[model samples]
Target: MSLSAAVRLRPGPVDLTSVETDAAPGFEGRKADGEAALAAMGAELAELQERLFAEGQSGGRRSVLLVLQGMDTSGKGGTLRHTVGLVDPQGVRITSFKAPTEEERAHDFLWRIERALPLPGILGVFDRSHYEDVLIARVRSLAPPEEIERRYTAINELEQRLVDGGTTVVKCMLHISAAEQKERLLARLDDPTKYWKFNPGDIDERTQWPRYREAYEVALERTHTEAAPWHVVPADKKWFRNLAIGTLLLEALRGLDPQWPAPDFDIDEQRGRLLDEAPIA
Candidate 1:
């Protein structure tokens, strides 16, 4: 299947013009066996993550940056929780960007993001990222129109720089419908345990869904590039979401072909020395 076709299968807020996927073999619509696909992909990701960990430990000079952006209650946190759990904790780092603090605001938009970039031999996941400058800033009217426009160019340049420097960036925008979001918010409100997840601001933002959608449309159009293309994952089905994201990540990691580093010395010689030093059993 083509990239466009694959995207059509998943649910997420997307600007089709911004989407560029070369023909790739995959399911285009909702897979009837999505649950099974997810389970299989989850297993594959687990195995690949181990390989990435080993390679990174061996001084492998590669890194991965997984960026997750979506509306409130779109399952970004839940996705991170399950997806990151499949990787070696020591080899992965997760950063959740909330409202900016005075310190964060002091720096340029990408400064906080740059500081969070994964070091060689690790995977870094940004819960919400630099995209906020476009998404939130545009919706909330936090910046001048000129400043907002400038950020789009600046962000594209920054991501391109990272890609050129050996960072493999997998950017995913979780697409959930407004109606679905409303349902999720209501679920959170009604469930006592999930009540903590509710915030009045969420409802306030819902009223501006169309505005935010337009903001995302522009954000995706301006920033999606060959170097760091965005993938819109269908988030309405949490299981399918996990599977799709996990599959994409596993594919990227496996494609890198990371392997364990060779031992520094002869294993036989080391074993012999240990045997000679030991007392009779």
Candidate 2:
């Protein structure tokens, strides 16, 4: 089965806690094997991204948007460094959402999201997304209960619209165990080089781990759709997380079947023109 089909959460209630954070769901290999697989995908991944980028510049309307959601130290950053790194930077547009500014808050929750969408042919990745309006808002009571409820429907509609507009939406929830998260947090504290990465607020967030898990369950259940289903990637092992996401992205790109656009101009004429032209130098 395709990785997309394998990791996709079915439309219904979900139990995030039930997923094994260290297990590689569809993959049968160990860490070394996973790393090797990811390495092998590098060339094709780069080629596809370049084709997709070229297609966009050639007036193709299709694009891709990868939505990655997870808790602290769930390897969102690592995905960027490893999985996403396989593709050319020119083809990718990344957005790391933070607490909204007053300007952003003044508008609807998705207002900023609309602006962050990847242009045609580009791959857009969101570290955290409008789901925050539902996840964090619900957990922290940052918005009215009814408002949070309304955002779920809005998110679904927006994703569907994006699909109709030729953007393939790939959503992945990096699932990490609480114990693993604690260890990762402690590792940061133990390393002087990683001290800057440490966040006291993350520990505060940990205090509400149960609430956050419940919030994620609700968000996944309510917003998961055929238009853009959520993939629960096992993230405790960095190698598996990178390999899975890389495979997922490669599959999505291949599904688009993006190809090099035929030259719009006459190749023979351009070649002759180039040969006849005098060098300015």
Candidate 3:
């Protein structure tokens, strides 16, 4: 099966434990080979993005939203830098959600999210998205059980509106094992450059790994719908993760198949005018 299909989380009950976090299911050969493939895919994605932007310039209504969710050290940042970073920055809107501010807490949980939705013809990325309301809220008891359930329905409805508004949503959960997370965190601690990336709170969060896993399972099952599907990307291997995301993005763009907008002015007339203009020395 294709990497996109292999990593996709289908509708129904999803057991996080059943999924492999370390395996590269749809890729072959060495890490270098995967990186090479990813680079090629990145080029294609850039071209597709240019076309998508141009289509929007010509009054096209479509856009793309890529939502990345994962545990700490699951390589969410790396995916953004290595994969999605290939596209033109002007056409990419990236929002990284941190703790909610006082004003954000005063509003609905999705209010900040709605404000960050990608504009028409741009590719928007959510480093951490609305799923946090269900994940952290459930794991940390930030909201009541009944309220958590309601958020699922609210998320579905919100995504439906986004789809109706010409935005295609692609959500991905980067899955990494506890052992792998430990290694990455330790490496960060040892490397002075990465020391800034470490957080004492991450250690505390790791203690509730089981609860977080269950929260993700519930969120994935509840929100995986026809309008917006979820992809559980294996992220222990960075190369494969990049390749997988690039492939999924490429496919989404391919499906959209955006074209260059038709020229408003007469092509022959413009060509003649250009020819008649003074030649450069």
Candidate 4:
């Protein structure tokens, strides 16, 4: 099965509590094996991404948007550092959404999101995406209940539009158990070098874990559409998380079957022109 299918959340009422955070759903590899596999995939991933970028330059409209949502210290940064880090930086666009600025707050929740979407042929990654309106907003009562309900439908519609316009949306939720999250948070506190990553607000958010889980479940169920489904990666194992997401990216790119664009000019003419002119003083 494709990695997307392996980690995809089935259609039904969602229950995150039942999922295992440490289980490597479809992979049978240990840490070393997973790392080795990712390394092997790097060359192919880079080549495929280059093809996609070239196609975009040649007028292809298709692109990809990877939306990664998770709780604090769920390894969003680490995943990008490892998996996405392997691909050529030129073909990738990454956006990390923080709290809304005043200008962002003035517009619809998706307004800022739309501004960051990938253009044709680029592989775009969202560290925390438009889901925040429904996830954090719902969990913290940041929006009216009625407004929250409306945003879900709006998100589904926007994603469908993106698909119609040739953008593939790959949504993932990095799931780590509460115990695992606590441990990660404590490790950050313990490591002075990671002090900057330590946030007192994250501990405050921990107080509402149950609420957040429910919010995520509802968001996953309501917005998980046929065009853009959600994949739940058990992220306690950092190595496996990287492997699964890396595979997801690989599957997405391969599905597009991006090929090198045909040279607009005659290849023979261009080759002769370049070869004959190369010895200029």
Question: Predicted candidate 4: what Cα RMSD to the true structure?
Answer: 1.3
Q: What is candidate 4's local distance difference test score?
A: 0.94
TM of each candidate vs. truth:
0.88, 0.97, 0.96, 0.97
Could you tell me how far off, in angstroms, the CA of residue 206 lies in candidate 2 after the best superposition?
A: 1.1
lDDT per model vs. reference = 0.79, 0.92, 0.92, 0.94
Which digits, one per residue and each the tens of the lDDT, describe model 3 over residues 1-281?
Answer: 87788998867889989889887877776799989998877778999999999988889999999999999999889999999989999899999999899999899999999999998899999999999999999999998999999999999999999999998899999999999999999999899999999999999999999999999999999999999999999899999888888888899999999988889999999999999999889
Best by lDDT: 4
How well is each residue in 1-281 modelled by candidate 2, as lDDT tens digits? 65556788977889987888888878887889989999999999899989999999999999999999999999999999999988889889999999999999999999999999999999999999999899889999999999999999999999999999999999999999899999999999999999998989999999899999999999999988899888999899999889889988998899998999999899999999999999878
Candidate 4 clash figure, as a count: 0
Off by over 4 Å in 4: 1-3, 275-281
Model 1 local distance difference test score: 0.79
lDDT score at residue 193, model 3, on the 0-100 scale = 97
User: What is the per-residue lDDT of model 4 for residues 105-215, given as tens digits with 9 covering 90 to 100?
Assistant: 999999999999999999999999999999999988999999999999999999999999999999999999889999998999899999999989999999999999999
- Name the 10 consecutive residues with the lowest summed lDDT in model 3: 21-30
Model 1 ranges off by over 4 Å: 2-5, 8-32, 278-281
Per-prediction CA RMSD (Å): 4.2, 1.2, 1.8, 1.3
